[model samples]
Target: MILERHGLGWAGLAIGLIAPFFIATPYALNLMTTAAIFVMLAVGLNIVVGYCGLLDLGYAAFFAVGAYTSGILSTELGLPLIATVPAVLVVTVLAGLVIGGPTLRLRSDYLAIVTLGFGEIIRIVATNLDITGGPSGIFGIPGLFGDALSGPVALYYMVVVTAAIAVVLAARLGRSRLGRAWRFIREDEDAAEASGVRTYRVKMAAYVAGAVWGGLAGVLFAAQLSAISPAGFTFLHSALVLMAVVLGGMGSTPGVVLGAVVISLLPEALRGLADGRYFVFGILLIVMMLIRPQGLWPYRSREHGTSTPQEAREPERARMEGTL
Candidate 1:
């Protein structure tokens, strides 16, 4: 399974590298770049929603925080775009703590509601603040590679590389010790706690990880657009990202990436349908859910010969009774 996954990863990287050579149109590059950023966002949210089972409706707040932070520093402080990354990381971590600290305690619908409210609060705050340009948003931001490598092709390659790295890192996290703790909480929080897992801290770590991912994606977004407005980071944005994660198999990294690409590019592919495209898209989503509610690529355990707790304990009990 690991070898197959690595093979697929290599194939994907080859395709991304060669795509520009085949379809080098500016519009196509821009669209592909946007889709890559969306992949990052969906993968990030997967850490919180898919891995830790935390439904975060305010995930876009971290995206906004990252974009605005990078935009403000670059435009106001006259810092280069790359220089703002450290600051973006710092602000996003703080934003995660501020929002996740209080809300991670709640479960299910309550947690979702609070997160939705927090997402709105962040948007409203950005809209009203003069520093954020009072809904006009920041403009004339610097390029990702500055004046040295400033074309659409350069930007596209840079974004693809960054997104690929993000996906790999997220996948690695999913296989780490921390990732196991998250899955434990997701499977059964009470059981995890009983087993000595620090549920709150584990959830917090997931939230922070997701926040950092979203924030980095935002920086990429800001670099791509060269400007941003409050209107860009709406609840709709968060919903679309969540949809990608759901449509792609929540805990399956490859599935999430494929889902994100499909969600991001499908509408564009349906442009010929005109205004009815959205209606068609909606119907398609409904059909898809009904057909494969588990997701496009539902997560499956790769570990072979693994036994359930009951099965493992049975051997111990038999041994205790000299029945082994």
Candidate 2:
């Protein structure tokens, strides 16, 4: 399964890398670039929601953190946007800990509510901050490259390559020891704890990882648009990221990527009927959910040996009993 998945991923990457050759229009490039950025966000959020079973309604807060941090640093210090990436990472990781450390203890709907509030708080704070340019936000930012004319095209390719690498890395993480721990916690936190997994620590790690991914995406966003405001990072953005995860098959990498592309491009595709685009979008989401709530690419866990928990633990329990 893993090998097959990788093969498909590589094929997709190849297609993405060469897609510009076939469709070089500016509109096409812009749409593809946007979809790639959206894919990064969805993949990151999947680590929280899919891998760790954490409902993070405020995932966009981390996105905001990265964007604002990078924007402030670059604009204030006369630094290049790329130069602020390290600072962005540090800020995002800290933000994750600050938020996840306290709130990850909550379960299900409670966690969702708190995250929702956190998302709102980040947006509101950005809205009021003078450095963030208040409601008007920041503009006149430099592009990723020195040349403005070629910057968009270069950035588009950069985003595609980066997104492809990120997807592969995320998949690799999902197959690692830490990934297994996340699955255990997702399956049953109590069981994972009983098995000696540090549930809180593991959850925090997932949250932080997700934050880093989101923050990086934000940096790309700031570079691409060369401007940003509080309005760009809102509950709606968080909800859409979550929707991509759910719509794509939460734990499935390929699924989430597909879902992000669909969500990002569906509106553009429907723009011909400007008045009814949103309505059509809503109907499509409803139909997809109703028809395949599990998602377009549901996760399929590998087969495990059929050893009962008690049987697997019997030797340890017996040894401990004898020692006692």
Candidate 3:
């Protein structure tokens, strides 16, 4: 099963590598790059919402934190885009601790409401801050690869590689012992606590992991646009990321990636409909929910020590022969 999964991943990577050959247009590359970044965001959120069962409605806050941190550092200090990653990581980790430390204690609706508020606060602060360039946002941010290979195609390839790595890492984490702890908490926090799992610490770890992923994606976003703005990190943005996780099947890595790609590209694919595209999109989403409430790719656990159908039937057959 692991080999099969890895084969699928390699196949996906091969497709991404050759995509430019078929549709090398700048617009196409830019859109594909954005979709890849969305995939990263969705996967990150999956760690919190999918694996850990934390309902976070303000995930975009971390994204903003990373983007603003990287943008401000690069634009103001004249640092290269790559150099700001360490700072972005630090700031995002702090943001996770500060936010998750207090909020993780609350469950369900309360946690969601608080996270929503935090997302709004981050956006408002960015709008009001001079360093963030107020409503206009920070502009002229540096590119990811600098002048070494400064082209849309090169940037697209770079973003794809980074997104791919993020997905793989998240998948690996989901299979680790820490991941099992997360699932335990998700299914029943009280039970997880009784099992000697430190639920609080485990939850915090998931939040911090998710925040780091979002932050890194933010750096890519800033590099792609060469700008960072309050408008980009809104409540709607957070909702969309959450939607991708839900629609893709929470806890299912491939599902989340597929969900993100569909969400990101569907609108553009419907450009012919123009003004009515969103309306149609809404209808499609509604239809999808009705058809597959479980999600496009729901996660299924592989149970240990489960008897095969044939094996079970053999026992039944023996019993029947003895009775006869």
**TM-scores for all candidates?**
0.93, 0.91, 0.92
Model 1 residue 100 lDDT? 91
lDDT of each structure? 0.86, 0.83, 0.86
Clashing pairs in 3: none
lDDT of 2 at 272: 97
RMSD of each: 4.6, 4.6, 6.9
lDDT of 2 by residue, 1-324 (tens): 241366777788888888888985888888899999999999999999988889999989998998888888878887778789899999999999999888999999999999999889999999998999999999866665535433667888888878877888788888677876776677678767776777899999999999999999998898888899999998889999999999988777788888898899999999998899999999999999999888877666543332222232334333323332
Q: Candidate 3 lDDT (Cα, whole model)? A: 0.86
Off by over 4 Å in 2: 1-5, 148-150, 303-324
Q: Stretches of candidate 1 above 4 Å error? A: 1-4, 304-324
Error of 1 at 16 (Å): 0.8
Clashing pairs in 2: none
Runs in model 3 lying further than 4 Å from the true structure: 1-6, 304-324
Q: What is the lDDT of residue 99 in candidate 2?
A: 90
Taking the tens digit of each residue's C-alpha lDDT, what string does model 1 give over 65-177? 99999999999977768889999999999999999999999999999999999999999999999999988999999887577677888888888999888998898898677
Best by TM-score: 1
Candidate with best lDDT: 3
